[model samples]
Target: MSFLVMDDGEYSFIWETLCDLQLIFHPKYSREGKIDHKELLGLNIKKVSVMLDRNLLSSLLKLTRDGYLKDEQEMRIIALLMTWMIMNNYPASAGLALKEYATKINDLIEPKRELREFNNIFDYYPSMMWLRLAEGAIDSIPVCPLPTEPFITEIKYNEDDDHLLMHIAEMLHVVYLCRRRELSPVEKMLDFLIWNYKYLLICESTLVYTAMLFTSQSGIKAPKNSGSNDIGKILVGCRNQAWDLNYLSNWSSFHYYEKTMDEIFMFATNDILLKRIFINTYTSGGVGALIEAVFSKSDSQKIFEVVNFNQRNRIKPDFGADPKIYLHQLIEQEKHRVMETISDRGNFNYH
Candidate 1:
C-alpha cells in the first residue's frame, strides 16, 4: 500500500538501469556476458519484488474502480514494471499472488481488438502500447552491443530519445516478427516504417535502407544469402501495396506521427533507395494529395519545409531531376532491374 514518488529524471534512470541489469544478469535475454556483482546492488531486489506484486494488483483494481480502462499509458507502465520484475526473477510466492492481476493486464493487451472501418494507424495506439510492453518483455534478449560507432553514440543521447533506442529497436523487432495475419500488408509496412524511422536519421548507407525495406516487406528476418531475385520480389510486393492518403491525413493528426514522417522526408532526401520508397508511398500510398493539402495548411507546412529544401538542393544536384520525373524514372529503373534479376536467375538455373 506504499506509494513511491520520484521525479521523472530519477525514475527514468532507474528504469533504464534496471532494464540493462536484467539483460546483463539474464544471458538468455542478451548475448552479452553477464557481469559479476562487485557488491550488492543498492536496491533490495526482494522488497522491490514484493512491491511489484502488490502494486500491480492494486493498480489494476484502482484503474478499474475509476472506470479508466482506456488509460493505456498507466496500464503500460504497470505491465512494464511487472515484466521487469519477472525478468529479475520475482519470487514464486509473489508471482502466484499476482497471477490473476497479471492475466487481466495480458487480456487487456492482447493484440486482437475491434478493427474499425475508418482505420488510422495512430488509432492502433492501445495495441501499440501493449505491443511495446510485450516487446520489452521479449527484448530482454541478447544482441551485440555497438560501441565506438558514431551512429550508436550520436543517437544514444539525442534529446528526442532518452537512451532508449536500443530498447526501442528490440521492441520493434517483436512488432516486426508478429505482424503477420494480425495486421494487413499495408499495416505491416507501416509498422516497419515506424520501427526503423530512427535509423533514417543516422544511417548514411543505402544498403541499410535497402535491407530494412526488403526485410520489412517480407515480414521475415533478413537473410545474409538473399539474392537479387529475392530482393526484387520484396521491392515489387511492397510497392504494389499503395498507401491511402486518408490514412496518412489521419496519421498526421497524431502527436508523434510527424516525427516518423520527418524521418521519411530525411530518408528520401538522403538516399535514392529510400526516396523511391517514400515517393512510391507518397504517390501511390496516397500521401501526394495530403502533401498538396499540407502546403496550403499553414500549421502543417513546417512538416515539409525542411524536407523540400533538401530535396530541391541536394537531390536535384545528384539527379538534376524534378520530383515527378525523378519518381517515374526510379520506378522504371526498378522495374528494369527486377526484370534483369529475374532473367539472370532463370539463365543461371538453366546454365
Candidate 2:
C-alpha cells in the first residue's frame, strides 16, 4: 500500500495568507459584510497567478467568474492572493498588512464581564492566570520583526482583559499553524496544559473542592495522624470516588475525562512533576499552594508520593437525598469555601 503525507505548515500558510489578502482587498467580504463581485472579477488573474500555484489561482478565478464568492469565501480568496505575494518575497507590505489586521483584532477586545464581576480570590486568581497566559501568547506572535534593544523592559497587562481572550481564541483557531510541526512528549504535555488552562486550573480546582466537600459530608474523615503522603492518597481516592457518582460526572464531560486520563497516564509513564502537582492541589495547601509552588519555582521534591488505588473500591457516598440536590449542595459549599478563604484574607485583589 502507498500512502501520501501532507505538509500542515505549508497548507496552513497558503490558506491563512489567502484569507488575509481577501480581507485586505474587500473589507466587507466577511459574513454580514457587503462585497462587490464585479470588483473581484476585475483582478488580473494572469498577473496574480505568477505568485500562486496554478491550482489555487485557477480556483479563485473560477469562483470570481461564476460570481460564487460571497461572505467568507471572498475573504479566503483574497487572503490566498495576499499569501502568494508574501511567499513570493513581498514581506515588507505583507508585514504591514498583518500589523493592521492585528490592530483590528486588538480593538475588538473588551473587559470580560466575568472578570469584572468576580468577588472572591478563587475566581479572580484563576481568571487572571488565564488572561496573563493568553496575553503572553498573543504578544509572542511574530507578526513584526524584533528590535535589537528590548522594546519594553517589563510586561504590562492590557487594560482590556477581554482582548486577551479574543487574541487567544484567534491563535487557537490556527493552533495547527502555531504549533511546532513535530513535538516531543514533554512539549506535548506543556501545550496541553497551556491550551487547556481552564480545565487544569478552574475545573480541576472545582472538582477537588467538590470531592473534599462530598467526602466530609459523607463522614469520611481523612486518616488521623497520617503523613502528607497518606493525605494525598485520601484526596485522590475522594476525587476518584466523586467521579464515579452521577452528580459529579457532569463536572467532567467524557471528552475532558478521556483527554485528562490520557495525560495522566503519560505523566505517570514519564514520572512527570505534573502528576505531583495534580495530587498536591487537593492537599491541605489547596490549589493556592499549587499556584505558589509553580510561580515560586519550588522544587517538586517536597511533594509527597500519590499512591494509585483501584477506582472500584473507593468510597461510595450515600447522600440520602436526590443526586441533583446533593450536587447543588456541594457546589454551594465549594463557593462558600472560596468566600470564607477570601474573607479570612481580607482586602485581596488582583494586581
**Which pairs of residues clash in candidate 1, taking residues 3 or more apart in a chain or in different chains?**
29-140, 29-141, 29-142, 30-141, 30-142, 31-142, 243-285
Deviating ranges (above 4 Å) for candidate 1: 1-14, 17-232, 236-321, 347-351
Each prediction's RMSD over C-alphas, in Å, is 20.9, 23.2
Worst 10 residues of 2 by lDDT: 263-272
Per-residue CA lDDT of model 1 for 1-351, tens digit only, reads 122333555445435744443322211122121222222233343222122223334443443234333555455554444333333333212222132232334432111211111112112123223234433432221221222211111111112121122222322232233323456433443444343342222121221232234335333233222233454443323322211111121222332343343221001011123223333333422333433332345423543454445445442223234444443444444345434544654742211
The local distance difference test score of model 2 is 0.29
RMSD to native, candidate 1: 20.9
> Per-residue lDDT for 26-54 in model 2, tens only?
11221111223344335433122121212
TM-score of each: 0.24, 0.21
Alpha carbon lDDT of each predicted model: 0.31, 0.29
Q: Give me the candidate number with maximum lDDT.
A: 1
